[model samples]
Target: MEKRVVFDGKLLPYALLMPQLLITIIFFYWPAAQAVWQSFFIQDAFGLTMQFVWFENYSVLFANPDYYRSMVTTLVFSCLVTFFSLSIALMFAVQADKHIKAAGAYKTFLMWPYAVAPAIAGVLWLFMFQPSLGLVAQAIRALGVDWNPQLNGGHAMTLVVMAATWKQISYNFLFFLAGLQSIPKSVIEAAAIDGARPARRFWTIIFPLLSPTTFFLLVVNIVYVFFDTFGIIDSVTGGGPAQATTTLVYKVFSDGRLGGDLGGSAAQSVILMILVIGLTAIQFRYIERKVQY
Candidate 1:
């Protein structure tokens, strides 16, 4: 029998929940409420006047073709970042899970990137790939390949995606490694004894077992690419090369702060929140079924 802890008094249970409830209200609910509230009102550039314009901001966003472009850019960025991050992390985790000399050192180095701030990571990659003075850029130019992220939209997009993926790989690796370690070695041994090749064993046994972790990381990596990569995109591309790498989050910043469009920015933020929530809901409703756990 499993034991369950129960509070003796009803008031005590409510009291125990108060801290979390307060935090939710203060941090999450309040800001969300504020965003929703602010989205309806158009404010002047001088901050001296305000006008209630319900749905106008959203109407404007829907009408603007650039907004749609930003949407497509965001989708592409998120997908690429999530795919590469998960793939690279899984590869590293598989190697690290194996018994090898200096495995701990390898893991330490891999994990060190995660400790770097996203903006700093972006700067590091920028230094490596910048068109003018970047090491990789110089090499590519030496090879006669035109690779100027500063002036090329496609190059800028690729740079941001690579930086974002690099930032997230370590986090995905940590979780994947933990999930891999928790699997039963007996199952793997049995698979090997059954004449299954390593690749076959991994696909049929290991990969399926890691589905839960993979799914979780997929969702997290998507969200991270959406929100957490703001610092990276800002530091690396500043949403430039003709606004090609401008993600939805950065779009919100551009509209709200730079463009002095508070209502529009709020609307963008709300739409973003809705998109993320809807995506997660869809994943849980459909994708979760395939997860082994």
Candidate 2:
């Protein structure tokens, strides 16, 4: 029999949960509520007066063709970031899981990037790819390719995608490494004895077992790309030579800060929130069904 511990008082259990509940209410629920409320009103440049326009802000937002472009850009960015980050991290995690002599050292080095702030990561990548003074840019130019992210929208998008992927790889690597280690050695050995090559064993056994973790990470990486990469966009391209790298989150900031359209910005935020929730639901509803666990 398993021993169980219970709190003596009902109120004590609620008391223990109070702080977290309060945080959720204050930080998350309150801001969300405010955004929803504000989306219906148009405010002045100074935010001095607000006029309720119902869905005018949203109507205007939807009517703009650039909004659709931003949507497309966001979809492409999220897909690229999520796919590359997971694939690269899985590769590194597999290498680390092999019980190498310097495994601990390698893991420590790999995870260090996760600790670096997104803004800093963006800046680091900027320095490495910044057309004239950048070493990598110089090397690329040397190879007969004219690589200037500042002048080229495609180059700018590629730079930010690379930075975002690199920053997130450490996080995915940590989770992948843990998931890989949790698989039983006997299962792997049995697959090997059955004449399965390493690649076959991995695809048929290791990967299937790791599907739950993979699914969870997939959702997490999407959210990370949506919200956390805001700082990276700010520091690196600042939405680019054009609106090339401007994701929806950055578009919200642009409307509020640069454009001074508070209502429009609020509307964009609300839509972005809905978009994230919808994506998460779609993933859990469809993708989770495929998980072995």
Candidate 3:
């Protein structure tokens, strides 16, 4: 009886996970496979005819300057947003881990932004930055700085980065907070007893202990900046100031939904997926090994 009971217990988790496994296969894996299939073929307008072109889409994408620029812009956006979000999150997490008064309140407030939808956040930012009525624009003008997303590609890129970082900081902070809390209290106390300054302790102990969380956040944040937040780009800048803010995903959206270039959009999607997969594989191979756990 005991043996049978133990066997049942072992099977219970698998039973519970079956639904999620089925959903993943149906939704995630199936769609990915279909996308890969569609990438090499062109579909007729009525979906009646399909012909494989054998990398023709990829060839055209590579040959196009605009596609390359969009790819580069996406990479730059992901890197800058990840760097700034992680930096700010770590700083706040460290402060919260000290159990400062009102730290819970601070954390709650910081995380509230993440609860809001990205599209709504983009609209809110637009309201705050619009040239004629925006407080930020007025302040910039008052300071004698020419801040215009209409004529300046750099400013448009900066706006997108800023909006992305704002939405990302809270998510990163939650992870960092958990990482900080999981550090053994005795280890920190021992370091302090040895006359280790805060900076030294952080560099030699706390930061190292937090490496796994940092790495996880890095991957997730990169993926988020890549695929998500298109609404933010669209609402705030419309990929404008001469397409400076037109990241790869945004370009895919514009081509497919707006320009009716289904084949071209599908090709761009395949390229984006490949880029993400390659970057993720490299991270796991190199960065994961350096993480303590």
- How much does candidate 1 score in TM-score? 0.97
Residue 87 in candidate 2, Cα distance off native in Å: 0.5
What is the number of residue pairs that collide in model 1? 0
My TM-score estimates for the predictions, one after another, are 0.97, 0.96, 0.92
TM-score, model 3 to reference: 0.92
- For 59-106, candidate 1 gives per-residue lDDT tens digits of 999999999999999999998999999999999999999999999999
Model 2 stretches with alpha carbons more than 4 Å out: 1-9
Once fitted onto the true fold, the runs of candidate 1 whose alpha carbons sit more than 4 angstroms away are: 1-6
Instruction: Report the CA-based lDDT of candidate 3 relative to the real structure.
Output: 0.88
Q: What's the C-alpha lDDT at position 8 in model 1?
A: 79
Report, for every candidate in turn, its global Cα lDDT versus the true structure.
Answer: 0.93, 0.95, 0.88
RMSD in order of candidates: 1.5, 1.5, 2.6
Q: Is candidate 1 or candidate 3 better by TM-score?
A: 1
Q: Could you tell me which residue pairs clash in candidate 3?
A: none
Which has the higher lDDT value, candidate number 1 or candidate number 3? 1
